[model samples]
Target: MIRVRGTVGAWPVDLQIELDDQDWAALARQASAEPATTAAAAARPSGDDPLWSRAQALLREAGELEGPELLAALAALAGSDQAGKRLLVRLRHCDQVEIVQRGEAPLYRWIAQ
Candidate 1:
């Protein structure tokens, strides 16, 4: 069984799709067949931009969020000289920080200490 959830306006909806073992196995095999290449993997940033690094560390530590949400959050935070306003907004919504914006930009410091 597969369960999916999404929101419409202010309401939330869920859907469940059930499959037999054979069908499940086929789906798993299909997924496993398409592995990301090394260059594609390496295109992701690996660095000390605090927000990107912190977000990555948090994701690793929490082991939650996947697919587009994960990608959007990561892309929002990554590959910038500093974490900007939009990334700050995303991070704040995730409860990752208490942010302060100066004009159109974000100035990030550690959340508490």
Candidate 2:
């Protein structure tokens, strides 16, 4: 059994999950059988991911930036648009970041907490 308690936005979250022996075995197998590349890429914790750090640093230094401009910068930093989008999504959900729409465009602003 696993229990998770936290808050999401304005709501509280309480979650409980149970797994039987077979489920545990299957999960262990899947975890151990993960592709080498995927496992290697995630060898470090998410907080230690260089790209994530760089993305946050970029936003911090910029203070505020337009969505498209930030995307282009992140793309350059990440070497691909798709990776940039992934970083953008991370930033969107980050508590320190606030997004404001100005005439159909979102402005990403960093608010240090």
Number of the top-ranking candidate, with TM-score as the measure = 2
| Clashes per candidate (backbone, < 3 Å) | 0, 0
Query: Tens digit of lDDT per residue, candidate 1, span 13-111?
Result: 898999999998998897777666765667654455577566746555545543335445556656542444345455556454544555654443344
Which digits, one per residue and each the tens of the lDDT, describe model 2 over residues 14-102? 99999999999999899889977898878634777888999999999999999999999999999999999989989999999999999
lDDT of 1 at 105: 45
Question: Residue 28 lDDT in model 2?
Answer: 89
The collision pairs in model 2 are none
User: By how many angstroms RMSD does model 2 differ from the true structure?
Assistant: 7.8
Which ranges of candidate 1 are over 4 A from the true structure?
36-113
**lDDT of model 1 at position 28:** 88
Highest lDDT: give the candidate number: 2
